[model samples]
Target: MRSIPSHHRLILAVLAGACLALASPAIGQEAEDGLEIGDAPAIMPVDPSDAGEIERGARPSSSTGDANRLDRGERDSAPPVTKGDKPMVGGEPDALQGINIYLRMGTPLPDVPPEKPYEGEPDTAYGAFQRGLFLTAVDRALPRAQLGDPAAQTLLAEIMSRGLGVKRDLKGAAFWYGQAAQGGDPAAMFKYALLLMEGKEVPQDREKADDYMRRAADAGNASAQFNWAQILVAGTPGVRGLTAAMPYYEKAAEQGIADAQYALAQVYSALKDVPAEKKARAREWMTRAARAGFDTAQLDMGLWLVNGYNGPRDYEAGYRWLSIAAARGNVVAQNRLAHLYINALGTAPDPIEAAKWYVLSRRAGLKDPGLEDFYLGLTEEQQKQAIDRANRFRRT
Candidate 1:
C-alpha cells in the first residue's frame, strides 16, 4: 500500500467538505442586516496536519466564516418593494440565519435505524463544526449509525473527519464514509476518493481515486463534476480528454456551479468557429453564474453587460451587480467599482465612495495601478484622512 502524502491529506479534507460545504446565496429577510462581504464568515481552510480534526468536523470558529454563500440560479428580478430599488432583500442574508440557500426539495431527515431515529436535521454538518458541538450531534446519533442508518453513517463520518466532538482518526473516519458511500451518497463518494488519494490512515490508490471521482461526478456531485472536467481539460498524459466531460460541466453549470458556468462561458466566448447562436448561449451561462454571486462571474458578466455583448447595454444593472460583487470582497470587482466611481460615468462619481471601495479592493488582494495613482493625486492631508478612514472601517 502506498503511503498517502501529507498534501493528499489536505486534498481529502477539501473533498470531504466540498460536497456539503457548497457556497450558496445568503437567504435573508428585508431589514438593515449589514451585508458587508468581508465581514462574513470564513470557509475553513483544508488542513493536512489536522485532517483528522477537520475530517471529523472539529472546526475552530473565526469571527468570519462562509456560512452564507450563494449559488447560481435563475433569479426572478428583485421583487417590487414599496421602498423602490434597494439592496437584494432575500437569499444570502437569510442563509446567515442557518437556512440552506437553494434548498432542494427532499425528504427532510431520512429514515435512520431504530437506534438512531431523530438525531437532528440531516442537511448540515456545519453548525456542529462551528459551535464546537460535535459530540452532541454525534452521541445523539451514533446509536442509529451503529444500527445501519445511512444518515448516521454520513454524520458520524463527518464528525470523525472534522474532529467535532471527538479526537480525529482518519482510518476510522474512512470506514464510516465508506458505509455512507455504499449507501449511495454522492458526497461520500467524493470524500472516499479524497481519502484514497491522500492515503491518510488508508491505502493510497490513484485508480481507486479516479473511480470514486467518476462515481461522484456521475451522481451529480457538482463540485466533483467540475473538478473532473478540470482534470480532463488539463489532459493528464495517458488519461485522454473525454468529450464526455463537456456534458458533465454543463450539468454542473445548470445546477449553478459557478466555476463550471464561468468555464463554459469562456469556452463559448472564445470559440472562433462557433456561430452567433453558440456565443449567445455562452453569454447566457455567464449571466447565470454572474447572478449567483461568484466574483469572477460577476466581473465577467458585468463587463459583458457594459459592453452589450449578445444583448443591449444596461449600465445601471451592471453597476448594481458590480457593486454587489465588490461589496463581497472580490478584488476585481473592487478595482472595477473604483474606476467606475472615479470616472463618474453612468453614475455620479464620488471620490470618497471610490476611496472606500478602493480600500476594500486592496484588502481583497487587488494591486491596482490606478489606485496608487489615485492615492498620489490626493493631497498629503487627504492621504492621511483616507488611511484613517480605512483603519476605522477595519475596526468596525
Candidate 2:
C-alpha cells in the first residue's frame, strides 16, 4: 500500500470532520423526526449492491468509520469492518469496487423497517401537510410556511409541484421552494433551483437555478455542489459553467463530498478543453475521489488501468475491478465486462464465461442494445450449460 502523505492526511481529516459535522445534524434531525440516525448507513458507505437493482453504477465511496452497517431492512448489531485494509468506506475494496485484488465481499442489505416520520409529539402542521400530501393540506402547509416553518413550506412546495397531497400547482411549489430556500434550507434551495431549471414549478429560469445551486453549494450541500459542477463543466444552457463551479466542487470535495470530487476529476479529464497539466491534476483528483470510495472512480480507474491513461497498463488488475463491479450488479460494468470478454482485453478468452456473466448483467438490468440482444440470442441449453459451468467455477 502507498503511504498517505501527511499533508493529504491533514486535509482529508479536516474535510472528513466537516462532512461529519454536517451529516451529524441531519442525522440527528431525522432521528428526532422518528428515524434513527444509527439505523441509516453513514454519509459514506452507501451499498453498491443497489447498483444492480437500480440499473446504474453502485453507490459512491464513504468515510473512514465502520461503526454500524445498517441496511434498508436488516441490522447487524456487530460492526461491519473490524480489520485493517478495509476500503476507505466501510466495505472491503473488492466488494465495493468489484475488484478481486483484496478483501471480502461487502455486506448486503438486510430487511429493516422503512424510514417514517416520528409519530409521537407530531408537528401538527407537518402532520396535516404530510397526511394531505398533494391532496388537501396545501392551505394548512402554506399558513405554517408563512409562520416560518421551513419544513412545512418545503412540504407544500413538494406537494404542489408533484401534485401529491395538493393539486398540481407548479407555481405554488416554486413559491414554497423559494420561501424555504430563503429560510436557509439547503435542500429546499437545491430543489427549487432544479424546478426552476426544469420549468416544472417555475419558469425555465436556468439562471435562477444556477443562482440557487450556487447558494446551496456554498452552504455545503453535496448534491448541489455536484449539479453546479456539471453546469460549470458543460457551460451549456447556463452562463457560468465549469469555471464557476470548479472551486465549489473543490470546497465540497475537501469536505468529503464524493460527487464533487468525481465531477472535478471528470471535468479535468476532458481532453478537448483540458490541457495536459490540467489532465494530470485531474488524475490526481480522481485518485483522491477513488481513495474516498467513489464508484465512478472505480470504473474510471479500471478504464485507466486498461488503457494506460495517467497510469501503467494492467489488464489483469482492471479486469479484477471490473468483475467486482459487475458482481455488485453495475450494469455498465457488466456491459464493459462483456466487451472485455469478447475482445479478451485483460483475461483469457472464455465465451462461455462471458455469456454467463452477460446473462447475469442483463438480469441486473444493463441496457446495452447490442449486448442485450446478443445475450438474448443464446440457446436455452447453451445458457443453462454456461450458467452451471460458471456456478461450478465460482464455487471452485
Candidate 3:
C-alpha cells in the first residue's frame, strides 16, 4: 500500500495494454490484411490513468454531465480519422498493437479477474467493486471480512490499498492481506509477501515473504510461481537452486508467463548439467517468449533462428522478429537488424534500411565501427533516405 511511483503507474498502464494486446497472437494473425508492413499502425502508449477509464468502459466526462455519458463499452461517437491516422486496411483490429516491452523482464501484470459468464448468483461485493461503487463494495464486504472470509478479506485489502472509497490505509490493508494469506488465499499470499518484501506498513521479513511466496506458487499463482522460481535460483548455492527452480519456472511458463519462459530458456541454455533434449526445450521456450512480444527474448530468438541453434535455420523469421523488436526500441535488435539487412541474410539487400537501423542503434549508444563504415559508404541520396527513416521511427 505504499504510494506507487509515477513510473510504476506508467508500467502498470503499459502492462494493461500489453495484456489486452498479447493475450493471444493467433487472434492477430486473423487481422493481418493485405496491407504493406509499412502501413501497419503503430501501437500508441496508453496513459496509466486512462487505462482505468478504459477498463471501466467509462465515457469522457463532459461539462454537460452524466446525461451525455454512455453505458459501459458504449461509444457516444465514432473517432474521426485525422490525416495521419493509421486505420486497419481490410481485416479485424490488430490485436498485437500496444504490446509492452517490460514483458521481456518478466514483470507480471496486476491480478484482475478475466471476463467469464456468471453462474447462479453473483457476489454483491464483487459486483459493486466491478461497477466502481467502491463504498458499496466495502460496505458489503466488511462484514464477511470481519467474519473471517478469506476472499472478502482479500477484497478489503485491495480496496484499502488502492484507497478506492476510503482513506489510504497501508497498515490496515497489509493486516487484511496477511489475514487472508493465513487463511490460504493464494492471491493474498502473493500480495502479503510483496508487502513484506517491500517493508511497506509491515516489518521486512525475507524468510516469511519466501514462505508466503512458496505457498502462493504451490497454490498456482503464476506471478508467485515465477517469483518463487527466481528466489530459488538466486538464493540456493550452485546448481541446487537452479534445479529446484525449474519446475516452478515451467509451471509459470505453461501459464503463458513470458518471464518464466525466458528464465527457463536461460536455464536450459546455461546449465551444463541439462540434457540435450532439455536444451532443445530451452529453444522452444525462448521462441514462445519471443512470440509473446518479449523484446529481449525476441533478440535471443532472432539470433537463434538465424544461427539454426537446436532447430532448422529460419532467417526470414529471425529478420521479422528482430525488426519487430527493433521497432519497439531494442538497441541490440536494431544493430542486428542492420547487420541482417546489410548482409541480405534474411531479407533482400537494402543498404538504406541497414544504414537507417545502424543510425538508430548508434543513437542508442551502441558503437559499431563496421556498421559505421557501411553506413558511410551509402550514396548521398540513400543516406538522406536512411536519415529520414530513422527520424520518422523516433518520432513515432
Candidate 4:
C-alpha cells in the first residue's frame, strides 16, 4: 500500500522558502472602541528561526507558548480603525493605497519559469547543455536548427547569446532566435522581440517587437504575457491603461509570474468598477506574490491584511507579514512596522520597538515627520535602546 503524505503540509514545506508562515489572512476586523490591550504581551520577538527555515525548506512550527498566548490570527484580530482612524497610505476619499509596483518593475523584469528539468538523458541538444557539455549542445543543435527545428534553433540561440562554450555572438543569436520565432516557438518569439527592442543586437523596431511580443503572449508564454501587459500599461497610463492590461496580467499571474500577480492585486484593489468577486481575489494574488519573495508584495499584503482591503482584515497575520518583510530589509515595511508597534495595532505598544523600526527606515532615507515627532517624544533611554537595536539589526 502506498502512503500519501499530507498535501497541505507538503505545500507549506515547499513554500517555506518564501518565508510563509500561513498565518490566517482572513480574520475579521476587531473593533477599536476602548480596546483593552494594556494586558496584552509586549511585542513578541519575531521568530528569527523562520528565516533560516527558508533555505532548508522546513515546515514552520506554530507560534510558541500556546498556554496563555492568544492564537495568532485572533490576537490583534483585524482592522482596529475607529472614527478618526486614517487609511495606511494616507490619501483623500479615494486614492491608490497599495505600494506602487511600477517603481521597480522595469529594472529587473519578471522572468519566466525555466524549462522543466530533465527526468533522464534525452537525445536532445538541451540534454547536452544541462550536462555542461555546451560545445556538444551547440554542435548537436546546429544541424537540427538548420533543418528549421524551432527548439534546436532556440537552444543554439541561447548558447550563442550566453557564450556557453562558444564565442558570444549576439547577431548570430538574433538570427537563430528570429528563425525559431518564425517557426512559431514562443520562447524564441520572446527572445527575438527583446533583441529587436534593445537595438544593440538588432535594429530597433518597436512595431516588430510589439508583434512578436503579442504573438508570444498569445501563445501562452508567461513572461511574454507579463511584458505585454507592461507594454500596454506603459502605452497608456492610469486606470484606463490598467483596465486594458488586466487580461494579460491575469493570464500571466495565473502562470505564476509574481510581477503580474502584484499588478493584479494593485488594479483589482484600486478600481471601483472591478467586480466584487475579482476585487476579493486581489489579496489572494498579492499573497501568492508575497510568498514568492516579492518584498513589495509582502509590504502591501501586510497593509491589505491590516486594512481589510479586498478581503477581511487580519491584523495579527498582517503584523507577522510586516515582520517578515521588515526582516527582509524592506524599508517601507520597517516604517509601517514602527507604526504597528507604537499604536498597538497588532502587537502590544512598545515605543522602543517602534523607534527601532523608525531608525531603520530613517537610515534607509525614508522621511516620516510624524514618526520623527514620535521618536523625538521618546525618553533618552528609550532612544538609546532603539538606536542599539537598529544597529544590531541584521536581515536574516
- Tell me each candidate's TM-score: 0.56, 0.46, 0.67, 0.67
Clashes in predicted model 1: 36
User: Candidate 3 residues 51-108, lDDT tens each?
Assistant: 1111112333532334322233434345644322244535544333444555545675
Candidate 3: misplaced stretches above 4 Å?
1-122, 131-133, 165-169, 272-278
lDDT tens digits, residues 1-396, model 4? 012122101111112211122223332221111111111111111222221111111112653453222224443545554332335434444334454454335344346679988797566678878866576676677888878889988998888778766666666777788788888999988877776765655667777777888899999998888777766665655666677878988998999987778777777766668899998788889999899887767887898889886678789999988999899888888889999998898789999999999999999887889999999999999999999999999986
How many pairs in model 2 have backbone atoms within 3 A of each other, for residues 3 or more apart or on separate chains, i.e. clashes?
20
Q: How much is the lDDT of residue 70 in candidate 1?
A: 22
The number of the candidate with the highest lDDT is 4
> What is the TM-score (0 to 1) of candidate 4?
0.67
Q: Between prediction 2 and prediction 4, which has the larger lDDT?
A: 4
Model 2: runs farther than 4 Å from truth? 1-145, 149-175, 183-185, 236-241, 255-258, 271-297, 328-332, 339-349, 357-384, 387-396
The residue-by-residue lDDT of candidate 2 on 190-277, one tens digit each, is 8777666555335566566677877888788767776565555444322234546567767767777665675566555532455677
RMSD of each: 15.6, 18.9, 15.2, 24.0
CA lDDT, every prediction?
A: 0.58, 0.56, 0.69, 0.70
Estimate candidate 4's alpha-carbon lDDT, on a 0 to 1 scale: 0.70
Q: Which stretches of model 4 miss by more than 4 angstroms?
A: 1-123
What lDDT would candidate 2 get against the real structure? Answer: 0.56
Q: lDDT ranking from best to worst?
A: 4, 3, 1, 2
Residue pairs that clash (backbone atoms under 3 angstroms), model 3 = none
Per-residue CA lDDT of model 1 for 1-396, tens digit only, reads: 113233111222222122123322121111111111111111112233432233233334542343222211234234533221123445433223333333344334445467746876654434454444465566555666667766667777877776655677666677777767667678877777666655545566666566667778899888778766654544321112323345666777888776677666765554355467766797789778777655656766776676676567877777877776766655666677777778865578877667777876677566778787896787777667666766665311
